[model samples]
Target: MTEQQDIQLTFEEIVCACDNNIDWVVSVIEEEIISVHGKPQQASYSGFQLSRIRRAHRISRDFEASVPATALILQLLDELETLRKGG
Candidate 1:
């Protein structure tokens, strides 16, 4: 029970925050780039997922990369974070 623990961003929120289309975000979801909570009829994202999505979105936009390429970059970044933690 802490900050960002239960902060669920709905599809509308995500679209607004990311300034992207619902269909595009839905494509990300369909690709399993990140998972969300809430009913099937009404999904919501967490801060962690939002951060990850932002990273991928940034990389995609900055480098004009494809979805799979963005995913690869995100995976590498996560690995870099893990290594930074001395784990």
Candidate 2:
């Protein structure tokens, strides 16, 4: 497999590792917890978004934030891609 293919496989692996629901994913994006540029920044994601989503889920689970878990999960996924692309 090529380097690009390996990266793609890694991304898929990360996505599969995420166990949160869609609702949680949305919250991550809405809360703006993770960003491509940095924190407190609104942006979109494109690559390695799955990894970010997983991280967001872990944070919410660990902190027990007031926001809905599902929403946060979605947001994390969305922002993750944007952050990964650095756009």
Candidate 3:
């Protein structure tokens, strides 16, 4: 993958990119619904992670799913995409 596609972003950047609030992001982090790659005090995430954050936030908000439930749904979606790609 290109560096652009794999670019890393700080938590705040992810929030703006995903249009999600910091509290929600922190909540997901605490729930382990997604992850970051830095110290706990300054966690950073990849561009792809921003995509997942967007999807998870939207899914949870629109469908009233809990963080764990949303994570499960996203996992299933990822599996579906992987299967479609024969990966």
Candidate 4:
């Protein structure tokens, strides 16, 4: 059987996947919405981190949410998801 490897994405790929710019990505990073594995230019993220970015991006774009607001929203959503999962 083949083992599955986690996909690691670069900073640019995350920005592209979220259809956002570097500044916006930086904003989310500053707000601690997601964590990176290296320096900004060479930053790397897991697929799960990318999901968080997408969710934050959507909230920011759709709700005109401030970085802090987006962070809080993500936290609440994560907690809700955990509860739903009976975790």
Top candidate when judged by lDDT against the true structure: 4
For 13-76, candidate 4 gives per-residue lDDT tens digits of 9989767588888888888899765576587788888888998999998999988999999899
Off by over 4 Å in 3: 1-5, 17-20
- What does candidate 2 score on TM? 0.38
Q: Which runs in model 2 stand beyond 4 Å of their true positions?
A: 1-3, 6-20, 32-47, 66-87
Better of 1 and 4 by TM-score: 4
Query: What TM-score goes with each of the models?
Result: 0.77, 0.38, 0.72, 0.85
Model 2, CA-based lDDT: 0.52
Model 4 misplaced regions, further than 4 Å: none
Q: Write the per-residue lDDT of candidate 2 for residues 3-67, one digit (tens) a residue.
A: 66313323234335546254554455456553444321233444566565666666667777555
Model 3, span 1-87: residue lDDT tens:
655457877767877754647777777777766765655348767766777788888898899998788888988998999999999
What is the clash count for each candidate, in the order shown? 0, 27, 0, 0
Question: Worst lDDT window (10 residues) for model 3?
Answer: 32-41
Task: Please name the candidate that would achieve the greatest TM-score relative to the true structure.
Answer: 4
Better of 3 and 4 by TM-score: 4
Worst 10 residues of 2 by lDDT: 5-14
Residue pairs in clash, model 1: none
